[model samples]
Target: MVEHQDVSAPARLRVGIDVGGTFTDAVAIDAATLQLVGQAKTPTSHDHPDGVAHGIVTALHQLLDQVGRSARDVVFLAHGTTQATNALLEGDVAPVGLIGIGTGASAVFTKRLAGLRTIEIAPGKHLPVEYAHLRDPHDAAAIGGVLDRFDAAGIRSVVVSEPFSVDVAEGEDLVADAARSRGFLVTAGHEISSLYGLSKRTRTAVLNAVILPRMFATADLVADSIARAGITAPLMVMRCDGGVMSLDEMRRRPLLTVLSGPAAGVAGALMQEKVTDGVFLETGGTSTDISVIRNGRVAVQYTEFGGSSTFLSALDVRAVGVGGGSMVRADLGARSVVGVGPRSAHIAGLPYACFASADDLTGARLSTVAPVPGDPSDYLVLDGPGGRFALTLTCAANALGLVGEQDYARADQEVAALALTPVAEALGLSVRDAAQRVLATGTEPVLDVVRALIKDYRLPEDQVVLVGGGGGAAAVTPFAGHVGELEWRIADHAEVISPIGVALALIREQVERVIPGATDEQILGVRREAEQAVIAQGADPHEVSVDVTVDPQSHTVRAVASGATELRTQDRSSRLSDDDLHRLAARSLRVPPEEAQVLASTAAHRVYGARRRRPWWRLGGGPEHPVRVLDLDGVVRFASPDARVEQGTVGDGTAMLPRAVADLTSYGDGGSRAPALRLLVGPRISDLSGVLDESSLIALARSELEGRDRREDLVAVLERRA
Candidate 1:
């Protein structure tokens, strides 16, 4: 139980709930003081993991009681969970069938093989019925075949996809209707991606379909739990994009919540620590994820999901298979110690309690050196707060060949030192360097691993903020001190961090228009395009704002379309058009064009200004004048006969014209044009010299003077020839 105090005259309270696979953590924060008052961690019940809410409410009630405050004082509730990620990853999710129209030629079908079932509608077929136009009209047969397949697999829901379906969803509607007739819950693709890209759009739709059931289940449980706890305050879920949204909306777009848990830690970490411009390393059971935070925001990189190279800028988090609890063995043939991971052992096999039996060879070595004789077989290892299972040092040591009196004869420190060298070498580090890096960091085994690797690589272990959720966290602490300024922090509950990350992430909705060429005008059009979209999304037209960012050298422009929402239904947009090229030309070369073609379009959106939009114009000139021209007058006689001309008669003058220039006398009866070029008055040689650079003048002098000498020499040579 935790205690809290209400110190404000008018009090405000907030609760942050992070739901994970292993445990659910609840932190009650005083909105007025921004101080944490209540915190709880409860073992997660996977079967009805939904039951974890009871523990959360119990903890909150305990805090409220201690503070002598009613539950009504709680004004804001923020939540993060991992239900959606697990549903997708463990294949313990809804059975969704995908109806991909306009995607018959797309690779989404191939990609779908890994997650859900997808059927591409026959191309050239219209809505209501693709077979409507078929001469044979075998629509019934086609429908029956599709339904039969769905029935065999027991699919509960269906997601539909079609090209440009947001605007022309009729085809997708018909497909959904046909699937619905077969008793499948249908989600239209047009309802998902009103944007672009048959493949990416379809993939987004498919992922939504696969995760919707889980999202709906979690949303319902959470809402019910909140109401049951006598809390009327709204419950908000964190999106993958790091924004909050109403649970209702999150259910519809659950894919956005895939990174909710990690995002929350990223958010919580950013809030608690002064970690700027560094990477956040989150180690868990299955993998170690690394993400960078720059300027206090998670920096996202655009890369392909999985193996397919679809472009998107997402938080740069890389999950390496190496984590604590990985298997260690000696490759006798190679005469090296190798730790192999990227896969995890069943938690039941190596419970943390039997440190020796935990299947960690390192743990076994430590136990042997300590010579602590506890009942090895009866060790129960329980994880989370419950501490459930059994483990033994012999299990870990025997597996790694550390046994009997011989191994036990070594001191714990000596054994650790002996193992450290090879481990460092395995990780490509020297013993001392590994120790330094490990000591610099805070987590036990992780820092030890970091140290080993650092030593192996002969690198300095820089102190960093470490975030991990695992049994190995304690063991990794000693070595973490080696790095300078390393602040070691672990998640309140570590095991399910990634799953929680998935829940709190935002949904990315992008819209693109294919406007040809880049130009200043087209750039304006792109912004208008984004604004119109925000308005269409039910935003107050006046509240919408369009901002543009440009990289002049690369001739790139990013336009951001955003709007404020009380409920957080923020829409973000990006447009990549060549229209901005005109601006670049004007800014870079002082020459701007009026119109342009769009080379590309890319945009991402959340509730606020999270996405980018820009335009680049490739072609088109100004409306007032498509071309410009100037006329040059004669050098010798200016409205005068050659005999009356003087060296000082002309004057220096220049003019701007709108179009191609022709000789003033050639176009019509000899008349003056609106604009003409004028020259300076001076001796012929002096006037010519003024306009030319030094090199030109030198060449002119050489040519004239040398030619005279050459002429005289030529004459002499001619006389000699004669």
Candidate 2:
């Protein structure tokens, strides 16, 4: 069972941990106060299966110790790791068996997926499979024969895909059932996506299957470490789309977390810096990731995995090979010096000049040499005590005084200047001039990517600002100033912003389907489905809000839902009086006081007098009774007609409420009686169940009001009973 923290309490601590290529960072925050309590960093371990887990545990313990807190004090824990991304990028994926269930085009589709074996069964678009095709004696034998072949080939995971599976998934389901019965890990295309792109959807399912084993192993180690530490807080993993999902959800769809680390940094910039519209630059030791935020939203697009498009939604980010640790080289052949990196000092197993000691720097050479294999750029090399090390852009920045002691990993300005002297001589320039040129060359690619993103997205130039984050943020700030006339700001705790972002991210789920000419009711259904999906993934149901978008021309509908995880506490002392309940029912039913009736009342929910009834013919319509209900405090809520709320009418307070609340009451009701009222206020639904008297109920409501606008926020619910 998932443990829920008491949100009604003053505050609960949340810890965010992010595992990067070079370092693992942790941050602890007081969610109620939105204040940073503590943070820690540890070197990332990559050689062992438990490497990431070790880093996470170390960082988390350090953070807790700094804050003078215990593991038990934590109410929420989230993690963002590059493990999945690294596995995919390094070609460390498991082999998969593709079970194609379509006809004419199935073979061609299967052939397009490299490194996967394919088998085709029945085919056709939306064709109903005969009962004999699934369970008949010969059909079962044929399916078993395919499984046998896959087993012989050592295929452990299978992807079941068919044409039009998004609309009708019976065929895919049949194949999945057969595969699973044979003890194979099965991925169904319909389960992976409801979108109409057959090829992309199939590729997505395959990708999910390929990455499942590695992700499961990593998740197990991390979760076990957290559990052994006696922390009961639910664990969430960051998603590439800049939100979070439960560990179980990530295990089922690990592909969605491919670029989660970069996404988390972008989310951090948005939340920590409070930038509504800006270009986010997350400069890590190895690479710089650039993403644009427009109209207060992170740009998301379908992700391409391993050179193939997948149905996963990810932050639209472009990574450049420029960072603090990029190697500086003199590209004499190109008539200009250049800095190229996606490789850093960490990958090269070399310490920056500023971090190296005199002994380590002994035998350093000023001769022009190509340090990188097969590269034509002549670089300055140092025969260190441990090994030969190349001078990098970080050393140049340190020499130029762009990175101060507080921000620079190593604060040896003298050593940086000494290291650059050799490069200056080789390049025939002054030391300071050489450093400046190196910085400029390293930043050019990053600048181009940022400018292109802004132009492509048509971001508002006047409002746009550049927000820098991550350990290499100092390397990005100079470029931010040089990029056009946009204002620039580096977020507080920029070095660990990704973890902070992971810590504060909300549970999110999105559902997209090709439902052409979808009615409002259909769109709403999709929205409800999305809300339910997120809630199931450990989000609080009452805190979930869904946004639905319908493109009639393309017949595509997308629904996104997000919710907070704070647990509400019930105020057992205050319960509704009989008269108060009657009044609430009357108001909710929109009837006169005398005409209103309370059919039943309970601590969980209440049932009001039936408003409308259907004939016996429509009575057994599925499992739902054909009757209308009223919002009698804890009772059934009447479904309000769907309508879009215009922006700015409710003020910014609504935006600050974690998520938007669905208004069951009309605007004329003074913006009260939201179903999520108790959730937003951190009170239990049963808190209003046992009030002794009308005056007492009024006093109870007033007493529960704690923050600014609390009274105004709950005035309508209180007024109905009063």
Candidate 3:
């Protein structure tokens, strides 16, 4: 019997629940120690709209029962579902009314987007002609007229887009105010993206608006289910970017949850395997998702919605319709060929040969082909009764002994072999060869995606590892050898890895602005906004770090704020006090505590303003110079020796901060190797891996920080790495 951890730290319980097409898997872990407590899987409820929620609740209850705990013990609960992805794929979305501002808008507002109605407000670029001409009267009337039309057309959601809105969004804002007054949920184009592509931004806004109603309903159902189970912890939903957001944030921007399930699986592989770089293969019952992890970070790309690209950042994952439950068939067309699916057995409503009943096999011809000693699905042929059915990848792996005995017990190998025999005969091949052929064919699509990611990222072939996850992981292992010399490993709890990823995911918020020639203060304002956004979503305020990048060329600045989920049991006494703040400022400026004045105080930290006196010798032998200094305009976080700091230094002269911070933090208290340093540069925050050594980076940072003018321009923090 497995020993269970004590429930004394009930509030430390973190539960991850993933809802897949076939099953709802749940895992409970001790968040503080990062130890697995218990795990359970329940068949996904597909009977009604509330099926996913029901399945999640069922799985959660089972997990708690196994560990002899209660729902109240869970301090954190995260969910990753296919509900949004399926809704988008199946054309199940709410109708949205789009109010376009500017001339030639009608040309781009075609029938390309499903369930969208368009109305042009006025003609102009930044501000519509009516808004620019009359400020309020004409523009207000125009917006009201559009809203009236949308209401008449039964539109409850609205997407407002205008040309050059990223630069001047007043026109979009005016339309949003009018639409909201008319009781419509509004998605503004500028709010979704700060890029210049109006068409893509408009499409993205429409997608976000249309998915709101359904996603809000789903969120409510999940919240209600958790409430019913006596768990009060904030519920988090995984995002397409491989991080998680609070329920409120998800409801506001459901578009981020698209493809979240696959993203979560990649996150789980990265965390559980502890690998910095690799290709993650998440094979589910219906599909396989492939993603790349480069230099300890999951690769991210703009989200593509229904074949149309959007400006939202999402995990760079490629999914193919081939997995454990994929159907095996012989296409006897112009050219006879053995095919593995883009379709699944569940969709066909046919049981796998291993799970088929004896009565279901009555008319099937049975032949003993290549019987593996104890495996049932291999070496047998059943070509009679119940129409032609064959073993799926899951069954094939079981029959060949590639799957562990524990997993094999879930299906009947005899039944699998019986169903596969006929397909082998049709192809004029032995059962063993046919089984091998089926596995290889299924792996081709996945391998192709893997090869593409490796080639595109120019990943080191020798360092890349293939990580298998999801229920069909066993099916992927058989072909790993054929993919070349890269190492391969399956994640622990591979079947339920997606949910585990969701549970372990950090809270992240990103803010992008197109401010041309922005001042240092304005850049810091945006970074602080991003940090607060993440904190509002349940992240610890002190643990949050903001990464900012400015492109003088495009005049775009993007900030990403991220932090670990705050625990209720965390020590609060260590928070910096007012006295501590004064002392820090004095120490930084080489002055007395009385000389520093508190300029501002936030909930978590304080900012002090001070003046340092420079002697005549330091100022070229003149009189003493009193230089005004912001001193230390930074948050006073609890000092954690193990904390990983992410410092964003701007200004043309501050280019060396990345290298300096990396070198300074590379060693621990006793000079032992501490946490690894990951550096990202450029407006897109491109990884600077292999480009800069520790000493080089340190020298650069020192050079940048040495100048007195650049001191207050850097925003730095010490927090745990996500």
Candidate 4:
């Protein structure tokens, strides 16, 4: 979903809404300044006939009122919903009738997929599926007979699947068209994925079919309500991979919105925080969802639902059961704190002790009792004027001044100390020590995840920053960063980061092909297809950039394209000046302003480098050269310890390709590998980092430069292989 956002400030406002299990949040951002101008929250209306859609509408209206802007002033509107994911978890889904088409071997393959008959969407609830097949896929009479049986059995949705549908989906399409004509919600396998995996593709499509009716109702309800508000801007929906897709696309692939809640937070980090490479931690009351953003894009992978592996690509988010409201577990006998939480104050129906009045904690005593039945009775609670209040991680952080005044989770320090004073006395340590110990224990689990991600992503050690978002972000990230000794900060409008992500997200589409021994032309064809796909969905074609990656083992060619919906800025004064770029690059490199000198420049970007001087104390660390690639807006898009930069025309780059790749390529016990490279032209950055084979790399390079004028600006940054 991360097509690079234009640095130019646009016009008007954009509204974003996020529907959570408990609350629906909406925020308005100034399109020209990207500033969060107004925000509102309303309790989720689950009991209403309209479901969460009603809450979203209410929040959006409240936000508009606060911002004093009419609906027409908004250029975009979108929301990240958890309804589909929650529906599967709660087993609130319609029955599916699968109409598989094929003959002989394909028919047997579809028949053997009996697992679809009883999928455990919840612990005790299962997804009901009825399977029916036809030899003549185009026979409307045969399809009607199958539908008659399904209708009698109370099935409301249908899935059409066939073998080799990726090659030609006519059979599946014919079945789908017949089903739709019969008023049954239809899902076609090839429409879900163009890959050759029949089983996975069918399963994914089946899951989509189950949620089709409910999601369709919500999308239609919202679209109608938005149109009634006089807003003609497209109503987009957040996808699980950090992009915003049109409402029509959502109606077709509602399953794509699964897990978009987490993706929305990281999308905010990518576009709003301008995070090129880092770990983003979004903490709520119960747990913290940790995800990584590399090279300005969110890391995504296929996700699993109810033990079923699907081709649903979503943000790779890992959750830890620890957050601000996490209750502290202690052992008075051992006089040591055991852990932070797997339970939170909200779940226990208790208010945070840090939010208590100082007078309420006066003469307060700590009593150990389990908040729920059949549990350990060592959780601490304060019994005083407040009767019973939970002592949680938020209280501990506030006590130690770890939660800043400006932070959303911040509370009165005096009240916080009073809440933790009992723990301090029980552990026979100072209140400060108690607070620190509690934080260290609480954040340890999250710290483990952070360390693993940093190493796994090969993030630049010196440049990797830890960004915190969500309401409880201050309760965890600050202390976690302190324990890990890394740079950290809460995001702007941290409480509403997810909605902000939804508002600022770009239009994105990814087209993947399984082409074995693919030629350069084939790769380029995929790239063009992806680009055209996003544009067809409302992206500005001229603003689009495509990244093509080929995997030899799977012979999978994936081209991801993204583009801004529109650009409204044209003034040259908004661009960064040379001095401004130098200061920013120098600060990012942790060197003097004078040391970070420009190494290469394109019309859209500049590569800055700083000399490395390992003192006499350090050996084997010399001869290192670090570089930072900065866009015209002063955002550092790429950072590395060693790299080579070159600027030229298309022809010049083609001629120097051999030297460019050879200079940074490495050789050792393993065979030599090509360097990671990127091409920076006017307002576009083509990522060639994922390509390893030189021939493939050159072919891709030629494809990118094919239509460009010979004398156009081109700059390449090649990272040295380690």
Per-candidate TM-score against the hidden true structure: 0.51, 0.71, 0.70, 0.93
Winning candidate number (lDDT): 4
lDDT of 1 by residue, 258-342 (tens): 6555566565544333243344556554455555554234644433433342223345555555444433333333434333332
Model 3 Cα lDDT, one tens digit per residue, 1-722: 96544557453688898888778889997776555668999998878678688898999999999988887778889989888877766666677776666644433442233222332212221111111111232366766676777777777887877777877888778778877787788888888887877778877787788778778878888899889899998899888888889999887799898888788998887655655558998887778888998755788878765455778898888888888887654443322335577666665555567667666676577433222234222322345556535457776665555665444224665665655566566667776677777777777778878889999987756557788887788777546545455678777778778888888887888787777767656666677788789988888865565556666567766777777777422234434455665776565444577875654332333434444444544423332212111212232211221223343344533444543454444444444221223322221111212211244323323322343343333433222222
The residue-level lDDT of candidate 1 at 539 comes to 38
Instruction: Give the lowest summed-lDDT range of ten residues in model 2.
Output: 124-133
Candidate 2: stretches off by over 4 Å: 1-11, 43-51, 103-138, 331-343, 347-349, 355-365, 382-389, 409-432, 567-722
- For residues 1-722, could you state the per-residue lDDT of candidate 4 as single tens digits? 74334446334788889999999999998777677788999998889987887888888889888867778788988899999889888888899998778788778888866568677889888867888888878788898899999989988899988888888878888888888888988999999997878889989998899999999999998887787778898789999999999889989999999899999999998988988889999999889999999988999999887788898888999999998899999998999899888888998899999998988888888888888897788888888887789999999999999888888998999889988998899999999999999999999999999999999888887788899999999999988887899989899889999999999998888888898888877887888899888998888777788888888789999999888787634345767889999999999999989888899887778899988875666444666678899987888998877677888888797787767887777777866677888888767888988777677777777777777778888888887666
Candidate RMSDs in Å, in order, are: 22.2, 15.2, 14.1, 4.1
- Model 2's lDDT to the true fold? 0.67
Candidate 4 lDDT at 150 equals 90
**C-alpha lDDT (0 to 100) for residue 29 of candidate 4:** 85
Flag the better candidate by TM-score, 1 or 3: 3
Sort by TM-score, best first. Answer: 4, 2, 3, 1
Write down the lDDT of every candidate, Cα atoms only: 0.42, 0.67, 0.65, 0.87
Query: For model 4, what is the C-alpha lDDT against the true structure?
Result: 0.87
**Whose lDDT is higher: candidate 3's or candidate 4's?**
4
- Find the candidate with the highest TM-score and give its number: 4
* Candidate 1 Cα outliers beyond 4 Å, as residue runs: 1-10, 49-69, 102-154, 166-170, 173-185, 284-287, 301-314, 321-722
